[model samples]
Target: MKRINTLGAGCLARALAFSLAAGGLALPLSAQAADLPAAVAQDLYENGGVEHWLPKAEKGDIFAQYVLGHMYCNGKKVEKNYELGMRWYRKAADAGFAPSQLAVGTMYFQGQGVERDRDEALDWFTRAAEEGYARAQSNLAALYLGEKGVEPDYEKALHWYGKAAAQGHTVARYNLGMMYAHGLGLDEPDYVAAYGLLSPLVENGHRAADELMQSFLGEMDEEELVAARELSEELQAQDRMLVALDQRAANR
Candidate 1:
């Protein structure tokens, strides 16, 4: 159903951008070594624990390099050194660690360790996204949506967002829902699709999703509401099946 000029000026786009940015997805980390207790490592990390991991990082341990980079970037176990952070992140990224690639992309995006280069950020994010990293996919979508230093491209944004959303990325789900709700770049709004995308988020206590759901419900008539509810159930079932399939594939 197309609702012409129903949304306030830039309202939907701004909401989508704010929700994505506010989600605050953390940088991914590799699993801790089975031999090394998580508590001990956490204690070390919080209390200048870089000494234990520095040797390993120097010896080309990707996990150690990532940890060291994170510590350096946040000044946890060492003085804040964005250059060293970038160096360590790059080492892991070059070794094909998806998390480190995402981190490096973020560094480039924020000008933390190097010049702020949107192109560099795009490159790193693309590498990680190609490897099926959901955060990187979402970030790449955001970049294409013009949240970073790039012109907005709705088609590219939708492609990347769909990838991330299929992987259960919360921010990407919210964004994709809003895009459907407002027909941001599409010829017509799809309220049923928006409902399907957003219903689970509202159930899970996402404030933004809840607000958007309220707005959506307020705008629809009884017939549309019934149709949206039915569509939402179908979408949820499909999502469950996909997750099950992914789990089975991972176990193989």
Candidate 2:
């Protein structure tokens, strides 16, 4: 698939490029603390209390290590130290923490504390994606589509995008919808599938998806429009069920 940069450019290329830029691959300090205890996590954000997490981080608490890494990276309570942040991230990642793995991958991709290494970033992203981290799956899809280092692989991109989209990742769903709408890397366009994917995105106030949906409807026939609406309803119901299942799993 060809890549284009402009927002109003060719359908598929523009959508894919927009996704690459808009979907930030990095995990911010707050996102890094998502797996931590709710009370402690909130306190860290509200008070910037790195001291509370430092001892636990030193004691090899995986979540604490990730939090310290985030704090150091953002200079929350400690001086900004990318190297120290990477060190803590690595400790947690080495223990198979998916979020820390994603953080390390982001650092490599952005050259935050180390040299930019797209290959290494891809490796770490693959690790986290395999562990069922939706963000990593989305990032991996972007990298595959963008051809950061390796040759562009639309098939691999679609696979990762589908995995992330199935987990209700908005960006991935938007990208997948665009791909289907324009027949990007496909033998034929699948407007019904595209409409189904984009419907929820438009409802969620995604301007790009809304614009695309308007364009799509202008081109679709009455019969196709009716089918698309039915398909969209089905997809939304399935998505809700998956979300409920995930919540139940998290509670357990």
Candidate 3:
């Protein structure tokens, strides 16, 4: 597979100064939670509405700003106002809150309230990704994989996917597996790698992975199936992916 050029001009790696952390990955978030940065919004909103977060957001609390942003954007006890949401998100984002950055990037990507700007979206995603935010990294990879204004950049996509996958991001791992299954950025599809990457997810009840496997199974022959089983067995013995993550973090 073609690797992303980290040193390329205007690449997502412009924020590569930060090093990966050495630690076991957190338990993966549900796909829905991974897609949006509002996993905590409901809980926060239930605990207190906009009235609770307003003063703190104004006091320059990034967490409060983020919660306030979510409430406004989601119309939780307040009218939906993308502009107000963006305003609060920007405040926290400017202060380097990863979730807020993801929120702002998502808004830009979706053209919510603000004019849709792919470049701006990429910028915010890159910022949060630099902070080792897995969702931002996954979103960044998706943008690089396919976006209107941005040309498909497979190397960049793979790079960010690996970064996010190393953090136990299900969506990133699924996307990376799909790319391999289709031979994208590679000489040919590698069923072993693809199946190995996805089988665990399928076993874990990822409906999408199970659906994809329906198509993929027809393509793999007996020998490939054997290889895939061996890969699975090896994973049970030692997690190669986690080791790779550790090495990358150690190097950093």
- lDDT winner: 2
Cα distance off (Å), candidate 2, residue 249: 29
Per-residue CA lDDT of model 1 for 110-219, tens digit only, reads 78889998788789989988988877788788777777458888777777777888877788888877876776656666666678778988998988887777776777
How would you encode candidate 2's per-residue C-alpha lDDT over 129-234 as one tens digit per residue? 8988877788788777764556677778877877888888788888877766766556556677778889998998999898887776766788878977877876
Off by over 4 Å in 1: 17-48, 221-223, 237-252
Model 3, global lDDT:
0.67
**Model 1, CA-based lDDT:** 0.71
Model 1 worst lDDT window (10 residues) = 19-28
From the highest lDDT down, the ranking of the candidates is: 2, 1, 3
Better model by TM-score: candidate 1 vs candidate 2: 2
In lDDT terms, how accurate is model 2? 0.73
User: Clashing pairs in model 1?
Assistant: none
Question: What is the RMSD, in Å, between candidate 3 and the native fold over all Cα?
Answer: 9.4
Model 3, 1-252: lDDT tens digits are 333222223322222122111110111212223434474645453566777889888888887887677767777678878899899989989999887887788788778879988788788889999998887787777767664456888878878877887778777888776765665555566666667777888899987766665556776789879977776554433336746433423543
Decoy 1 TM-score against native: 0.79
